[model samples]
Target chain A: MKMPGFDISLVIIWALVAVLVVLAWRRGEGRLQRGLRRGFEMFLINGPRVVVALLAAGFLSYFLPKALIAEWLGHESGWQGILIGSAVGPFFPGGPLVIFPVLVALLKAGAGLPSVFAFLTSASVWGVHRIIMFEIPMMGPRFAAARMIASLALPPLSGLMAVLVIRLLGAPAGVIP
Target chain B: MNALKRKKASLLSEIFGVPFWVFAAISLVMGVLTWQLRGPATVEAAVMGDIDLFLFLVPRMLGGMLIAGLVQVVLPPEVVAKWVGAESGFRGLLIATVVGALTPGGPMTSFPIVVAFYMSGADRGALVAYITAWSLIGFQRFMIWELPLLGPEVALYRVLSVFWMPVLAGFIARRLTIWTAPPPSEEGTR
Candidate 1:
């Protein structure tokens, strides 16, 4: 809930933006204006989608009981939990802001490290929303298809490795909160 | 030139064009269900909570967008492609991975950069590596989001486990591209 790190990160990001804006101004001939305009345009385009997505994520989180999620993704659930996590990843919408928090909640509710990692990997690698909206449209269907096909094994593979590492290192099986 | 190249589309059209509406519809259904199942108070709390999140997100989102713009202006596509073009090989893929990790913004920013690389003769493998690295291992995302939410240990393990993914995906993509490439034409009598 209270993320000091997020606040600090935001400050750093804004500082970087300030430096870049100054540099753009010095670059001469409408560069700064052009860049700002472009940035604003992007914000406008993405803002609505982001709002709807976040609200939806909130509702979804509220609707899905944490106990149920934990049960499905808990440590004792084993490889099945990992599989379910991976399968659910692509369908779990929203950007990092939404996804990470939901994941943290799941972890807090007793989900295993392997399942959490699998969910993160799959969501990042093969998010259906991203693949359809950005990849297919911007990068072409062929490129999207190739990348998806190539990444098909990554979620499970990452989960397997996580499980292996936890066993080998004798680490706690759940997320180390 | 870049200005002309930028696509012009309204927010409404873009939202409707994709499965965004589907997501919205799902959200609406979920909202109604929550209201029915958990009472109106729960729905109100969720909506209010999201509003708080939205306010928190605005500044960060804008900052990210500005950085994305600055990246576009400063790092010319030609320069990016030269460093990660076909001839750059494994080194290119490595550089792409690092670039992708460091490059800021979400898909809206990264995909255009990828398109630029494609036009500038960057290899498909490198492009794939770049996208994969950006999506899977972006340093900014890790530092800002994952560490704060997931904790250091989980984030570290996730990074370690998937660090090799981009290169592997790139390699596979390269092989697939070659396999799918059209066969060389036979010499024919004119």
Candidate 2:
């Protein structure tokens, strides 16, 4: 999915940054100067997350068959569909950046609202990517496993819970997966 | 050069370095432990699912670091601050939320700013909401990549789904008493 027109925001952000850097450079306030340095450091720190999203974007595009997967989940069915949606949600690494769009498409393709919502929330909250990248590194496999068990269950719980809430609040303009 | 090397070496000293490498040992132990202690399918799924995802996700995550660097160099802090630092009510939360959606750098992007916000007396719930909103919504991504693949209806729904999430998150913050995220351990905790 390429929208050259929308790509302008990133380029625009850069241009704006350039202007701000110059303006701050001229003003030369001590606080702003320090902030500029910290800003640079932050860029260094966050640089990789961007790459991860892009790659996840690619992974989702290449590996997953969207409509088929949505159908397999039986998204239009009632409680069972929500169960299926939530169950499949966490394992798929694609974030809402991909999931929601896919969810909307799934809806058009015949998936139901609650199922889509369940999938979106589950995917967002309990993604598999971080289990691999984060859990293994910081906590090691044992703790990671514990967390995963707990986390995996939560996605469905969130969906089911959403039902309890949405049933009460009435899914104002669509709840997420 | 020697002094710089010493600094770098100390930073990567045994205490920090050993644990990182020893993750393999831990993973091995955990695998065996789970294999012995847990059921067959549990161990099998754990081995297949998490490790595969870890393998696939880490390199790209590392790559995401460079994009974050480029974004910072490109967008600077003040612009980020202006865009993200609106008031804490619904509108303010909305601005922060959408900005977070559009901008998709990891913790490294706003964690520092979040620290600053914390130091400057940001509300606890609002900060939580801000971070959540940012990670959940990738506005730039939706516009650039999603619209084309899924078409406008899906894309528009995508936008709308996220549109109120941040605000919802902020309001929900008041209700979620369990988010003991250590009260923004930094100044400017946006």
Whose lDDT is greatest here? 1
Tell me the tens digit of each residue's lDDT in model 2 across A21-117: 5655565545345545545443333333333333333322323455664565443466777788877777765344445435544554455555665
Question: Per-residue alpha-carbon lDDT of model 1 for A12-127, expressed as tens digits?
Answer: 66898899899988986788888888778767766676677766767777655667767778777778988998999998766675577577557756678888888888999889
Shift of residue A103 alpha carbon in model 2, Å: 7.4
After superposing candidate 2, which stretches have Cα over 4 Å from the reference?
Answer: A1-72, A94-117, A128-177, B1-74, B82-86, B107-116, B177-190
Q: Which ten residues in a row have the lowest lDDT in candidate 1 chain A?
A: A1-10
Docking class of 1: acceptable
**lDDT value, candidate 2, whole model:** 0.49
True contacts kept of each: 0.60, 0.02
Kindly report the docking quality category of candidate 2: incorrect
TM-score of chain A of each: 0.64, 0.51
Per-residue alpha-carbon lDDT of candidate 2 for residues B1-190, written as tens digits (9 for 90 to 100): 9998985576446324443334444445555666676655656665454344334433333333333334444556667666455455556666666555545454445556655554555554455456555555554344334433344444444444444555555655534434333333343223
